[model samples]
Target: YKAESGEIFAVNPICTHMKCDVKWNTSEKSWDCPCHGGRFDCKGKVLTGPPAQDLEVVNLEQLIEKDNS
Candidate 1:
């Protein structure tokens, strides 16, 4: 999760459709799955097909646990 305006927002690094890693595209302000082309906006909204569901917004608690592990 990235911190902004005193709050945090983050998503799972992997895509839901095929378990592919989604990389951040700063220039495009979106996440794109390299394997299947699933796309999500920076806000985690579904921007393209193949993956119908939106990316999950990670909570602060979850993010803390992940960091600990």
Candidate 2:
């Protein structure tokens, strides 16, 4: 996710709770899992439980390089 200050944060879109897919919560600016109500901040830090572990952070530079290959 890109913050208002122009900082970028990338994380795995899977919830650590039950391996469910996480969707963006625009109003809250967080990632929310519909299956278990797990919420995470833009940096993938757990904001609410059902999820105790933070999401895996993805390297933005690696992603960009891979996309260009």
Candidate 3:
């Protein structure tokens, strides 16, 4: 996610609770799990849970360069 200060953070698209795939919520600017109402912020911190842990953060530098090329 992009912050107002132009910092970017990324997280895996999976929910920590049940391993369900998470969808991006543009309105909330968070990752939401349809299965169990788990929510995570852009930096992978848990916003709401059944999830006792945060999502995994991914390093996208390589993928960004590859996509640009």
Candidate 4:
């Protein structure tokens, strides 16, 4: 997600709880799991869980480089 401050936040979209996909909550500005109600902040920190671990942070620079290549 891109903040108004011009910072970018990215994470693996899979929920740690049951491997279900997470969806972005625009009103809440969080990643929310449909399966078990797990919630994560923009930086991928666990806000609420069935998940104890935070989502893995994706490397944006590496991804950009790979896409360019």
Report lDDT (CA) for all predictions: 0.81, 0.95, 0.90, 0.95
> Candidate 2 — which pairs collide?
none
lDDT of model number 4: 0.95
* Candidate 1 least-lDDT 10 residues: 1-10
In candidate 3 the C-alpha lDDT for residue 57 amounts to 92
State each candidate's clash count.
0, 0, 0, 0
Show model 4 residue runs off by greater than 4 Å: none
As for TM-score, the candidate ahead, 2 or 4, is 4
Q: Give the residue spans of candidate 1 off by over 4 A.
A: 1-7, 61-69
Candidate 1 residue pairs in backbone clash: none
Which window of ten consecutive residues has the lowest lDDT sum in model 3?
Answer: 58-67
Q: For residue 19, what is the lDDT in candidate 3?
A: 95
- Candidate 3: regions farther than 4 A off: 62-69
The local lDDT score (0 to 100) that residue 25 gets in candidate 4 is 99
Model 3, 1-69: lDDT tens digits are 888999988888889899999998989999899999999988889999899999999888977898999
> Using Cα atoms with residue i matched to residue i, what is each candidate's TM-score against the true structure?
0.73, 0.89, 0.78, 0.93
lDDT, residue 18, candidate 3: 90
* Runs with alpha carbons beyond 4 Å of true place in candidate 2: 67-69
Better of 1 and 3 by lDDT: 3
